[model samples]
Target: MATDYQSAISSTLQRIFGYDRLRPGQEAVISAVVAGRSAAAIFPTGSGKSLCYQLPALLLPHLTLVVSPLLALMQDQLSFLNSRGVAAASIDSAQSREEASAVMAGVRRGEIKVLMISVERLKNERFREFIAQVPISLMVIDEAHCISEWGHNFRPDYLKLPDYQRQFAIPQALLLTATATPQVIADMQTRFAIAADDVIMTGFYRANLNLLIEPVASDDKQHRLVEWLSPRLQEGQEQPSIVYVTQQQSAEQLATMLTHHGLNACAYHAGLPAETRDTIQHQFMAGEVACIVATIAFGMGIDKADIRNVVHFDLPKSVENYSQEIGRAGRDGRPSDCLVLANRDALNVLENFVYGDTPERDGIRRVLEEIAAVQDGSGECRWELMLTALSQHSNIRPLPLKTLLVQLELRGVIAPRFSYFAEYRFKYLRDPEALIAMFEGERQRFVQLIVETSNRARTWCSLDFDALYRRGLESGVNAERSRVVSALEYFNDKGWVVLESKRMTEVYAVTPTPLDIDALSDDLHGYFKSKEESEIARLNAMLALFESDTCLSHRLARYFGDMQAPERCGHCSVCHGHVARLPSPAPLPPLESQSFVELCDQIIERYQAAFEGQVPGVDLLTRYLCGITAPLFTRLKARQSKGFSRLEAYPYAEVRQWVSVHLTGDQ
Candidate 1:
């Protein structure tokens, strides 16, 4: 007679996923998990990383618990699995009260073979309670690099997952990430306490992706982008594309511009209402939107595999971010273009972004002072700056110090972002019959709308609250929307239902509210003074990239430690002889304080008069004064004066920096 184990595994793979063979390193990783060994799988984007763990979960005796980094990812993956007739479910912040209860009930009944959740969700007391009752055979962490401080995206709550793993005694655990350097891989192994032999890494090389970087003048970047895209967009031959911008407003502006140029496009960013984001995402996924211009927030949880091109409208924060963003393209084994619209100014923007966020010398000094006051100075690795910093703050002594430093780098802060998921249990104050009786006329129609929205999903009522409110208002409901919102909150507070919300806390550097030059310590004072001077040099270095005659791809790759071959990639603007080398303009002399102050007052007065008592914020004023074409100002034709363009002669960022220093007394 055939063994039940072999039969079950085969049936699970064929019946559920209809797959005949596992991808490259999947089978070995699955076998290791089956043998109850903890493993880490570092596969490239588009590699079948999910199958490595998902297949093993089917063979395991206990429920497989997957800790995903994003709720959207969990929902999408769960939906896909369920559609394939697999027993999978996810509990996240989006889940409705009844839906969460039903999922919990399923877990209790052993009906859910695989349960997906976000790391933030694992921190909840109730979720912890639920986990305690379930026998988890395998614990899988998606985007496991977040656990490593050295990883591009460092999530603080990810540090807490090991405790959960230990508490659950998860027989086997798996860590998965699309992008991890060799250092990051080791960091994951050390953090998870996984054996060296169990760590599996598929190489990061993706031959289908043609990484091309185009260098242009910052002022001409938009024109260059339009020229480059005009042909392909007009032809409409390629698969859907995504344009990633550094800012939310840039995404919106670019999307609008692209649409005006006759391309189907939409903007996606976190600042938009969740319903709007969901609608845009769905439309993009359904091919209703041909291109989505978005910030980093847009693509984290997206799994659409046919993205033909990924364009960077602005440079990413780091080389790792650049790699990961580009990885999103060519997922379908098709030739895909990964383009970066680089310029000297873009690099300055990235550098300034880094310097602006990173703790200054005084802030660092304060943290050191705190450490010295509290902890004993053993002085094991005084030369190791990052390790010493981590040792002073976090309690995890054996954790990878470099990883922590990387986290600090990604966060650009002394302390990582504080994050936790909140669980709210709801209790209905009235019986179902009484609740129904409470509604009449417009209220009845509003109640009906809520019921109709709730019917969208069997287990989760992922209703768009804003859309529901709008519908209620359109139905002539005189009732205040706040009452409905309060009722929902009351239900959650009363334990009639549970709602989970992920809260992320950001900590600013501990320093004087306004930086006082006069009060600075001698050494600390010198550092800031030097930093101001050094920024000009840094700006020059950025400009150098634009003027460099080398292949743009090779130059970027070299910056990220990739050794260059002799020949240049013939596809870039540099190689194509389209790049025009220009001499650096003479730097402006530092403005006298009295003159600068007078100029600021004049600009402010002009802005107030122009807008008729409605002056824009400091950022907008700075942009306007510096001759930057802000989308809103451009659309309104507000910056048409000669004075505006003349201001470009000065370093706009430096001017802004000075204005901030003088006004807020903070740098």
Candidate 2:
């Protein structure tokens, strides 16, 4: 039996993937997964983490459902799978309804062995219902570190994956990540019910990556980067590099700077159109573009193996980010330069990001009140909120709002149900009579009635499913909303109409616990405070790593739970005796100055309505002035005002103090 298993693995590995052997930790992870045990694979980036699940996916029965974080990641995986003649499909919002419908049908028929989707896809009510009926053998979560609230890239949606597994009755889970600290590893193990012994963690040290840190004045940093990049962009090497920045605007400006210096460079960020981002990525991969200036959004699932340089124009938000970003280079067992242009200027902006995400206590209470008010007829609540609308209404950003909701769920206040589109619009391709004629008898009459009742516009028809459901009950016909939606989807599948959905609202089942809104609000606020402190501490830790006299590579490896890494890598900045304190830029004008105070007064009076009917408190005003945009801030065009980011260079705490002392008179 042992020989047969070995032979099967070798033959499958060679025949399907054309690989001779698994990378370190991949075989063990695959073994655990194939044995029907949950396992975590903690490998560094570009270390073949995908193979841990990809290989097992082929051997698993029924299906392997992979929850990836980015569409680019899914597309890359799908392209690889398709090239290998493996049955794989992805259903994403970018796909037309016909395309998504086809993928669903293939899943239902058990024709697609591997399915990739974003975690947000699991929130779809229809998709959830469809998946519940399918038999899933394994569930793979790429970048699984996002599941932990303590992780640097904590996403609230990822917290629901375990529940989703139970809902889908998936028997085993394979959690994968390129960067997970000891804390994040433990969190993944606990959440996924994986045994500690089953977790396979390869050490984080990559000898081929030569780490370097440069400290310079803010004004001279651009010239220094150009000097660093020009050498690499020479005719022979034309080395591909990625310049990581903190903001979209920074990406654009820096890319323009690089291009002006006569180097091939382009900016990539979420702010850019999807097609443009894709084009830039493709150009980079094809070696047409020598450098990519991007925010964190650019490199989640890119699999370029020969990237020669990874430079940080600004300090990465955390150590994990720095590790992952640098790991992108030196993947092909060749020496690659990983340089960081470190300084204190970007610290204020980074810290403000932390503070901005920490929602106010009053805002938290208001959200709770809103949730509590959404009770049903039996005093039980299945609260379904359009998150964007709720965010704007409560003056909380969507991300922090999601965190609050997740915290409430953890406290047993509510459990996530499913999300659904609030409206469905369709346009008929053929005549309504022709569509009805395709059906017969009762079905035909039902289709005719549906066409007749739909509200028609210029070229599209809208269906009010709620009204139809009520009218169906009145007429003594079983016209469930789901049934009607399925009908519309069927028409779409048949090319009878083009169906479009809009306004996805997430539903939660609220528990009938005793009323304690005040306690809950306080508890949630404390959670956010703790998270904020932890994030700031993470930033400080990264700073310490750069500022210390230790080997840069050794310090990074140790931070990611690699204790056995050598004392000196001999390739990093410290080993080469190149180190300096990162200097801060010149200070801004005092907050108490007459000009600044007058500007603040004008801002408060002019943008009062941007507060969304709430009294402009110190916290909200500080966030607004610091350019940390909240939902209401953007919805009311406050971000467009000149005063929005006027104080962005100052510390958030100082701004808040000034606001309290002068505007609110709280001090």
Candidate 3:
């Protein structure tokens, strides 16, 4: 007789997924899951990674909780799972109380077999308790690399996942990702306590992809891209491709430029409205659009097997990132192109982004003091107030503040209370006057006041009730931010507006302990410093791909624990002799032409002169030009100065290098 493992998986693959056989690594990973052993599946993108869990979800008796990185991701996968006639549901802030209750009911009734959620969703006490009632057979972590500090894209929230999983005593766990280095893989294995044999990794070699690197100067990069695409456009060909840019703005500009010049192009980035992003994703997938110019945010949930090409309009920040992005192409095991328009400017931008994360000791100290000052009247446990507090202390945005807050919580100085949005925005599709006219008594007057206080110049307007309350509109403030949220929901239900209230940060309550402010601040500073160094190394690794004479696949494969990787592969630029040799352009301009070098020097001199003993280092100067406010800069309130982003168009490393070389002699 066939064993239970072999018998069940074979039939499920044929019937449920309609696959003739398991993809490489799928069988082993699925086997590990079914046998109740924790495992990490380090498969490349589009390598049937989801099936490893999907099949197990069907096989297991209890609910398999999946934590995806993005909201759209969970929705996309849930839709597919439901279509396959599997019992699945998701509980998130996007759902109403009644809707979430219905999902919770389904879980209680054992009607839902799989539930997907974001990592941050677990922080809510309600969610934690609700999930406690449900039996968790396996906890699946998609994008598992995020759990490790050494990961290319580390998220602090992931560090708590193991502890969270432990609460359930979840019998089995699986970690999955498209890209991970040997170090990242080791980190994940240690975190999950996976055995050597259970940690499955498929080699990162894509033979069908033509990995080509073109070294072009800053001026010619755009033109070179056009020249490559124009012929394909002229032939009236429709090849589903993605052009990855360095920023959301560039995605828009480049996509618009391409559309105007007669190609079916659309821009995809995190900055776009969620609905618009969903539409673009569907359009691109259905072949309604020929290409999408996007940042790194576009391709996570895409499993399209026939992507014809993936063009890097700018250099990627890390080899891990580059591998994950390009892996989207050649998924069908068909010939496809992976082109990188390599240049110096992209490197500067990447380095600048990394340098900006390290805040000064004073800024960290200020944040802690504010948290301590505000606690239970010694502070406010409310997340909204904490955001307002941070704004007053520094120019640190909510995104970085979220990371910093997580670090603080890990240090046990604070305990997380909750998180909510500070404000919300929605577009009124119906007549505002008519809607106001619906209420006639004192209620109508309050409604009118709320509307008048909001920005109604555009069809889409936003309201921050706290501001109205602080500005003395106690009528609406009487209900608090929740009352305003309810009104938005009411209008949404009435089809008066489209609501998008997904922005916010987490709030933590203070623990009963005097924080060793100096030592903790120093340790936090060192943590950020180490992260910056690690990120800088990652960027350099990506650069090495361009500089090295080795096979592209081999270069990538070896990074992910494949020591047996060959030096020469017939598919890459070096092996095929396709690496282009172009002239190095003129160096960055000097002081007279208003170059960043001169601006950097001026900014540094001013800082040192103003603050007697304090010297601005390369990291600090880099952060300023990149519009990144380090703690010291925030303490100095230098973000308000005009010189903050004077040389922003150049690379951070290049400008910083120039400044350091010049300053050593002067100092």
The order by descending lDDT is 2, 3, 1
Q: Write the per-residue lDDT of candidate 1 for residues 582-601, one digit (tens) a residue.
A: 43334556654325454555
Model 3: runs farther than 4 Å from truth?
A: 234-236, 374-385, 388-392, 420-506, 564-566, 579-585, 589-622, 626-642, 649-666
Cα-based TM-score, every candidate: 0.64, 0.92, 0.82
**Per-residue lDDT of 215-334 in model 2, one digit per residue for the tens?**
977889899999999989886678989999988999999999989998888999999988888788889999999899999998888888999999999999999999999989978999
Q: Which scores greater on lDDT, model 1 or model 3?
A: 3
TM-score head-to-head 2 vs 3, winner: 2
Worst 10 residues of 1 by lDDT: 505-514
> What are the lDDT figures for the candidates, one per model?
0.64, 0.86, 0.78
TM-score of 3: 0.82
Writing each residue's lDDT as its tens digit, candidate 3 over 425-459 gives: 88878777988999887667656766777776546
Candidate 2 residue 402 C-alpha distance from true site, Å: 1.7
Q: Which residue ranges in model 1 land beyond 4 Å of their true spot?
A: 1-11, 235-239, 356-667
**Model 3 per-residue lDDT at 238:** 79
